[model samples]
Target: MSENTPLPIVEEDDWYRDHLATVDEHGKRVWIYPKKPKGKFTNYRTVVSVILLVILFGMPWIRVHGNPLFMFNILERKFILFGSYFPPQDFHLFVLAMIIMVIFIALFTVIYGRIFCGWICPQTIFMESVYRKIEYWIEGDSNAQRRLNNAPWTASKFIKKFSKQVIFFSIAVLVANTFLSYIIGTDQVLAIVKDPISKHTQGFLAMIAFSFAFYGVFAFLREQVCTTICPYGRLQGVLLDKNSVVITYDYLRGEPRGKIHKAVKGKEEEAAKMNALLGDCIDCKMCIQVCPTGIDIRNGTQLECVNCTACIDACDEVMTKVNRPTGLIRYDSEEGIRTGAKKIMTPRAIAYTSVLGVLVLLEIILFATRTQVEGLLLRTPGMLYQKTDDGYISNLYNYQFVNKTSDTLALEMELIGIDGRIKWVGHAPIAIPNDVTEGAVFVELPPSELQTGKNKITLRVRSGDRTVDQVKTSFLAP
Candidate 1:
């Protein structure tokens, strides 16, 4: 319900909580035609969206040290972040980084309610700044859109609707390709595009599916994603409190709302008395008209509120026209609106911040100290020590090396403490970028160095005279 809805005799204030603003009492969806929003906040959000979109589209193509700036190739168990290559061996680091990000978002939410959703969320940016703006350009403003929808299907209506869908799907396709590039690398995505569809059927189908999913989200789902599907929106009820800064209507300054009126020349005293009883708000419903999620700012904070600031701009514009001060709807905590005191550093916020800081630091340290190459040396499972013709004891072994660098690694291994020589069963492995190399080798030693059951052996692994890893494993002998 909005400002225009009639109040019920009982539970009038609680009615809005009973159902979503986009749902009717009969449980059907109420289509919203939000008025095109303008003002400083909208302009600012447009600029932010443009920058974010540029970064989102550009990141996959941007390379650092021969690696994509960011990649998470789960298919190959390879990940490259910034210029650093992380094989499956560094999965721990990736998990830690993810944890840090989650904690940071939670901390931000505790201090500023849903500001990320309004200003930085990809959903809000694409809906409000890209797709919705294009919709307004094609269908005109909210009134024109409503009228066109209500009117029977005409040639002009069909043309506008068709043109909008074509553009929306085209953009969705582009976004899907960009998203795939982040997962599989830009070169792979380009290969899929250049290759025959039959050759890359799975990749081609994945791209098309992703495109359709995105189109559905922007074209039809819209605000429902935020209201019902997003876990972050649901978390707001637990994360937010009276001290959290949000887009709030100043009930102290805007309550007892009445329509603006002019006084007659002789009845100025009566007009003044009437004005004294009213608040600054004129009940124009402009705030509701501009809200993307179809919420009334006058009803205080709700689950549907994204802190988009469209209502703020609309209310400010109305206030300016009516010769009243602006900020009827603006950024403020509930406590600030009631008591005029703003406090953002609550105990929950501090705790989350502290945990986030430690995680970030731990991630940094782990990344800095991580090994460039890792090796796993194991003795062959079924083989026992064999006697060589030259009076030497030989043990068969298997070795695996993980390369975490951009360059190829030609590994060489030698016995560290034992007097022995390594003979490759076939050839020693040459590790490639973000790949694992495995091989079998024989460690031959004199009988003096052999133990009765098992002997401790140390292997020093090197690449072109530079030590890579020192691995210790058990060598079996009879």
Candidate 2:
């Protein structure tokens, strides 16, 4: 800790250090303006972005049994996943599903590192491919973008800047609508758009709020979301190990690094010096220039790196220009880079895989054991047992119907145990909502029907004029 002691190299570990732009001596949030990336990986990412964009935008309309395959209607407290309805009563199931998903993500991250952050995540897909591309399109590449920012707002600058904002805001609005569709369902989103002011006033307002936030995030907020905001990104240090494959610089091959051109003699000497002191790296700073998180990979693994492969592509291009073999930077573990170890299946990875297997089995078993039909019978409040003309004791009972089915059910309720006659107040079969429980009526009979002090009464509900659900209740008597 003394001034005489050299600062130790910052090692990446369980705790993530601040990878933000604005930070105090105590790690904190600061703004960052990342240089837009280009090269092979960026090209691959663009293709991937297009595919993801289609899937994201298309998901709302993709129907499962005429319902959205995915809808989390927080407002209605109704969740429909893959056409299976989950009401408030299924909250335990929802919690379990969430836990399973979180564990799956953790296991995947432990094995493969932050490939999700770079490749599959919506944040990265939108920011890197959509907004960043637009930024590059309007403001030019990194250096020109820097220059344009520094330059005053002339008519030319004003128009270009204005155009970018207009585009950004437009995209945000589209994104907001798509995002809201997932929460409120495609039908509600359509109602908002089609009916506008009259049908969905609150929903319309919510859409606007979401759009503005998305705009702010993609435009001004940018990389801070990954560096400072995202908890998943923060979890990477704990989830990832030395064996996890990450975007890494091969310092052994590329270090003691100097410009390859600078060390050149003529032809053979140029190649030899290029192979010697300079390694393969041209020191073009292209990798640094393209990084979205803006931390140098050559400085060793840092929390800021998203493993987007921008550096790999950039370095490969540099190698190509100098007629050298590529991969100065690649997806590799620190051990792999140092010891030339390939990405073999390790003990830690096997353990994660085993855990994942167990989780999958548990999920399957839990799903398989779940009941399809359920019922609830409640005694009508303030109603006592009544003696009928035929000496039959009648008890007024409220019956609830729960049908986890796609088809409309016509349930025939029957009271079983001892001698009893079941009659509905309405003489109609019990019917329920498509994905909800409906309450109706029933009356049970016979004084001798009560076998015990408090008899066990069973009410059976039939789906097709046959018994499907059976509910047990305590029959009360003096």
Candidate 3:
């Protein structure tokens, strides 16, 4: 430990570190054929994925207060959350919602690693649970798939490949329709489906493009989406720490691995007597076989690992068969595996949680206080007040009202502060439709109530007995 003593140079394992598992030194794509995984964790993930998928697909169809529960019509700058309508003016609420979601995801990653990517991500869920299952049914397990790929193009191969493609294409179309529903509402999507291609050319083309994109993603560009494309996967390196719980391999117990053999049956006692070194890992390689990302869990926490827990299940099954303790791989933190210390509430995690909590509270408050109607009243440009024969000063104004609710509203406007009478130019009571209504009105106030050339007027908008909105504008006076 002396200062004069030179530190030893350490060589890094560059083979696996230099390139992606799905690529080779020649830069060609190395297709992965992951063995189908099954265990308690996979079963739990399946249930969760199914529930999330149902919500994603069915939400567009569910109506709340006669409005689609969730719709983001970006083309028209309109968005609806729950039953509340948000126009271009309410874009702040949408931005706030997005910020809340980002903070929530960051906090979750700081605490629990990439559990969301593995269990609830739509890409993973549809790829593994749906498309991959279909592939397994048609092409069998990894070995069979590999064999089919290596074999010549025969009738059997053609039939299997063609059938799988047909089904995959159909599912992709369905997924595209579901995705379009979220953007433009299910009713619009149904109209596009029922009408001729010439009627809705853009929508029809969009549907076709989305279907092919989905097909290419699920069938060809599967794991690359997570490893190479997704920004969240790359962000794990910054968000995760020693305390973050992830699917980790217990290298302390499994290192210096040796293959199991018949000679090792009674060798445990002999090794113990001689102080011989031997670890629990038998090097079965089952974990690698079941990994969708094609990375070895024993190499430590890699970006490719989605925290899927497939390695844990595979390793546990192997350990049980060999009469060794399970959990050679498990859901644990780096510190837990290295020093046997489990801690979830680190200082960084606490900070993230605090910020996330505040954002969520702000969102709730914003939604609760949002008005059902919006109104804007302004004096007509370059217009002067006219003194009527009755000694009343009248100002010409234009009014615009936006109805956020689903029902038609017959609105009446009254001056709030001073004594004034509101007279609609065309109608006695202005009828505001569900979207937007514009009209002109004349506000006549007694000269005794007028202050100066420029006066502030408060207008109250009412629907029947309920006051809906209040708007303030400048009134011109001589």
The candidate that achieves the highest TM-score relative to the unseen native structure = 1
Q: Give the TM-score of candidate 1.
A: 0.94
lDDT of 3 by residue, 213-298 (tens): 99999999999999999999999999999999999999999977877544467687765643336678888889999999999888
Model 1: weakest 10-residue lDDT segment is 7-16
Error of 3 at 248 (Å): 0.8
Per-candidate TM-score against the hidden true structure: 0.94, 0.87, 0.93
Model 3's lDDT to the true fold? 0.88
lDDT of 3 at 16: 63
Among these predictions, the greatest lDDT belongs to 1
Clashes of 2: 1
Pairs of colliding residues, candidate 3: none
Q: RMSD, each candidate, Å?
A: 3.5, 4.1, 4.7
Q: Which prediction has more favorable lDDT, 2 or 3?
A: 3
- Model 2, which residues run further than 4 Å from truth? 1-36, 196-199, 261-275, 343-348, 369-373, 381-393, 415-419, 427-432, 443-449, 465-467
RMSD of 2: 4.1
